[model samples]
Target: MKVFLAIAAKVRGTGVERAMAVARRSIGAAFPVPAEEVTHEEWREPGAALLAWTNEPGPAITYAAGVSGYLADPRDLPAAAAGDLGLGGCYSLFTCRSAATGPTGADPVYHAETPELHVYGSRALLVHLVATGGRVEHDPLALQSMVRQGYFLSDETPFAGVRALPPGHRITAGRAEPYGLAEPTDLASALVASVRGIEGTARLTLTGGRDSRLIAATLHAAGIPFTAVTYGTQDNPDVILARKVARRLRVDHQVIAPKPVTPDDTATRVAEVLRTCEGMTSAYENVAPHTPFRARPSLGGHGGEILRGGFLLGCQDHRRKLDALFLGNLDLLTAEAAEHARGLAESWQPTPETLDHLYLRYRVGRWHAAARAGIQRSGLRIQPFLDHRVVTAALAVDPAERATQGLVHGLIAELAPALARVPFEARRWPWSKPAQKTPDWRSEPGDALKSAILGSRELAAIVRLDRVEPLLYGPRLPKPALVWHLATVATLLRPMRMAVAA
Candidate 1:
């Protein structure tokens, strides 16, 4: 059984209503379910109001989208009724309040405004809650569990009372303050060492993009053998470029074709993967589903962002155009949502002048907060861009040189011209052309054999939440937004979960 819960509130203006309406319509379109056809019941009483909806009674998916006040109170009788009725399978709880509101200790306990969004999930329930007007008090046990599982996000500050897992679960925060100078040579060695430390057959997910390619080239130069993996539908640019790199290196390369997955299968797979990893199941449900091969000692191209000076570089490059675009869409988001994002940015100590900081601190933070709950679930080992010494060195470079100086791939190209010839493609590639082009790699003779040797049944069981409708939206949610949210959540959760689980 999977259930989702959310707490929603009526905004002062039409922003909340409009956003909700858009979200609901989007979810409906994606899921293709009629609103009126949805089975529903509503309850109204003094100091309490309730609405419940379900489809296909037994072991069915249910989601609750509630207002912050509603979530704070959650009328005991109604909660009991839900439990008695077995109302939700996988639950998502959303805690919502108005952005205009501020937290007051003296405010109504049930209706106080909050700024945090908390989401939790289990086989039987999924909780998604957002604190709209105030900050919700952290629950120690919940926070600990989330951290151990790698579900929490926010690089600026640690959540109060939460600690990273002991021993294996802990990745040394490493050097405390940022190193002042760039040390690519040392960083590269560390990156290589990290990959070499992994026992068994190691694979690198090569992209035409510079990050993975740099990692791949480094490994190649180090004389470490690695099988490269790529994914896409037929003739995808990444597939083409990865093959070129593999051919140049004379290493095994595999391309995974995307497959349409069903909801039940996704749910079942995610639950199994989470159990195996002993972590929370998150939105990156599809990642596990699409994995061509299983778990092994492996390396991924993750630290590219930090090495390249973060997404701010790109945002800066197109600031003028983006400003225009943002102005156009400003009305699309609720004022409260905007205000919530602003308040969050301020709390994070972001400089008002840095537009990029504002965007990340507010927009990205909100989305990550909502999605981090899921990432903590997959339990996969993740070596983020922040972990690599090369990245650290890159960060140490003058901000002018580090920011949009060039693609990290370009830097790798400078280091190893021969390896740079290998092609990779990502939507965000700095270059206009695809990374590398080659003969169809998916049909290569040894691809299937390699998959058989490296794939894991456990990894395969991780579900793609985007494929599961009920987990994403309540009976009332819009389909498109549900799909978007599902995909976003899956990506965040799967990698983190895999990292922690390993």
Candidate 2:
């Protein structure tokens, strides 16, 4: 939460006043700072720092760490610090801005190279901040992991000096450990409070998914007026089920189709999403969903999986098989790099709590949150599931409630039985077929995909470009997910090309 602004740092050609405002609004703290002076809590440290946006007031850990709800009991920190840290209710992004002079003592300096952009930093800051010319040198391993799959084995970012603190884990005096995972309070009341907090022209995105449905039921019970919206093709399962949900709740609903897309249009939109996502995930055609909503701070369901065990629906729970299985679609990688990435996953500390923590940090935080960012840009208000109160409750609840999505079912059936009586639709798409039990990507080959892969310097250099011949010319690749990554990688590289041009 502490911000160290370099001397003469200007975010988007503005003084500290505007830059500081951007940072405050990002985390939902809006205290006014009248001058371009150092923040009070920041004075506890040497550099320009802002007090972290947290409810609990405690000593900020001397090591690189941030806490959200309850700072785990201090007695627990020393013992758990050595493992993969997942402090259940904390979040922090960190970097050591020194040149590569590894390990002055016990702690090695973390490399950070993201250019100064907004007061609130993000991956997309590069496209805007780097144009006039700050170039960030990325680690090769980090770049490959982001492009080939979705995340790197460690917390490394594309820019060398920057690394994020993995959730549920925090550092103290250069040591890292597992943040305590258990929360004493359950999530039911917290979730309801989250829904009730929305006021003044509020909106919700209702997919056929349980998270959205639960939120809808809660809103109905609370007597809150919200207009639920669904966007996709007319027959898409989300659209249809959301319709049933709206009708049953007796609330207003709206549907927004993707404006017609051309290859060029797809390229433009994909690049926009990549800018916000920091090239961590790909953009699909879902970009038009938010245009119809004029509401501020739209609600979304992000951490629903934490309660449902959604990430590993059927995959083996252990590390080896999960490593092989999660990376199954990325055949485009050369044998060598692919093996290294798999090796990393294999060694990943395996536990349900740890797995859930990482999934929330990377998959939902980076990939899903980034996708939502791509869709709404600045439109989305908040995702209650990711909130600190929500996280604390989820981590604290009994494990049995999470299995088979029992938590979701229990809450809805208890809160709004009529809505639950209407069975959940089995299909998640417009016209899904068994197709050997995989997502059906058997649509005719897309020219946009081929163009995206072939037209960029960054994609050509990193991927075994020669290995992608099948995708570009010879045959239809059956995986929609793989195609998406390729398109996203292509979109991320466009800015690199533009940097060259200007």
Candidate 3:
């Protein structure tokens, strides 16, 4: 088992160095491996300094700890607790100068120095840890004590086969269950149960989306004390609708504005965020390019996709019509590619095989696998949507009820009029406007040239190809491939020479 940790903090003169030293000492005491430190030069692009350690030929457990002056939302505490408690075998700690600046591209970035740590070995382990915010403690007596108090147990990672949580633990809503099986009333009751099970503060994510709104409504109906948070540009529909819903519920609401990402900064920042996420299910998962971590246990509404069915149901319907139309009209070349694509498409049909594959192959299965590896490496348990019962219910719902047009969850809103009243409107913000209007740089010749100069060969090697081939020359690439291409282009355009130097 190998363990790695990255810490970020602002430099407070000599005190920052002392803090780093102390953090290293604490980590070393908890793990058997020797730690290594890598300090960033002042002018470096990703300026965050890092300390990493790996354990080999030993137990698969890895521990990581990050300390920042920035205060996180109390709701995120469970995740923090889980990450910290899980420290054993191998450990890494990251100490930043200050939390005021948060984690910006130029402000001594961390994680870019290492990327492979983000891969999780198991999805179930990752989901369980993130959802509960609990880790397997080293002390059996202590673990037993926490369990007696109602903490949950978690063991969804690859390295360590088993993990335990203290009593009163709760999983995030989206990851709780499949979309359709649970009735609105049942979901609401589950939310209430999760809240009641926890001691002290709880945070609820409120968005214009029905799932979040429903959760908030349920919390209110249950008289649970919670802080509601919404993030986006001010004009985003979610921001607008969330505000309205918060007002109606008369709960405290906090709105986070989206940050701006220039062509020069996007790739590095995305990579860093991904590294921090380490245990996420999707390679595309990020904490919004601009927004820094503000609070913990950030309630994510990712389960909405399952609740409404996968995002591609409508496209599937459209393809079915197109297939009928083009039965004999399409050329052989197009037909061959379409044949393969069609099989992939048809695999998503609402059937036992499709449902099982969706859950095991993509949804929980893959997600948990990625998450397990990431959590071990980064020590950050990212619980996006880990409500199991809710997800199971969603899976049981008929496919017709899970509309591609966002009508399925919408129908649920109709069933619960009060839920429909919760506001969920998308709004655009001033800062985001410029980027939205800016032409994609990958289409520009200058960007392409820059890419060729800044180690295109290396990029090619990472991609396992002798040359950068045009997509038009081969079979159509998958969506993930397209995103990686864009990301590679972004990386080339933004040379980290200056950022790394600082």
Instruction: Give the TM-score comparing model 1 with the true structure, all chains together.
Output: 0.43
Q: Which lDDT tens digits does candidate 2 get at residues 296-361?
A: 546656567766764453445546535543465456665665665666566566555556555555
The parts of candidate 3 lying over 4 Å away from their true place are 1-185, 233-235, 264-296, 316-356, 367-385, 404-417, 422-502
Q: Would you list the rank order by TM-score, best first?
A: 2, 3, 1
lDDT of 3 by residue, 334-407 (tens): 23333533443443444433443343333433333333333333322222223433443445555445645355
Model 1: per-residue Cα lDDT over 1-502, one tens digit each:
1112222323233223322332232222111123443443333322222333322222122222221111111233245223221111111222232111001100011111122222111111111112211111222222121221233222211222222111001111111121122234454554554444444556777777777777776666556677898877546667777788888778998888865543333334434434322232232333332122133445566435545544455554444533432332223223443343234334332222344333333223222323322332222233424332333344445544545646566656654577765544545345555645443322222322223212322222232212332423333333332232223223223422322100
TM-score of each: 0.43, 0.66, 0.46
Report every candidate's CA lDDT.
0.35, 0.49, 0.34
Model 1 residue 344 CA deviation in Å: 2.6
Order of the predicted models by lDDT, top scorer first:
2, 1, 3
Find the number of clashing residue pairs for candidate 2. Answer: 19
Which candidate ranks first by lDDT, i.e. highest? 2
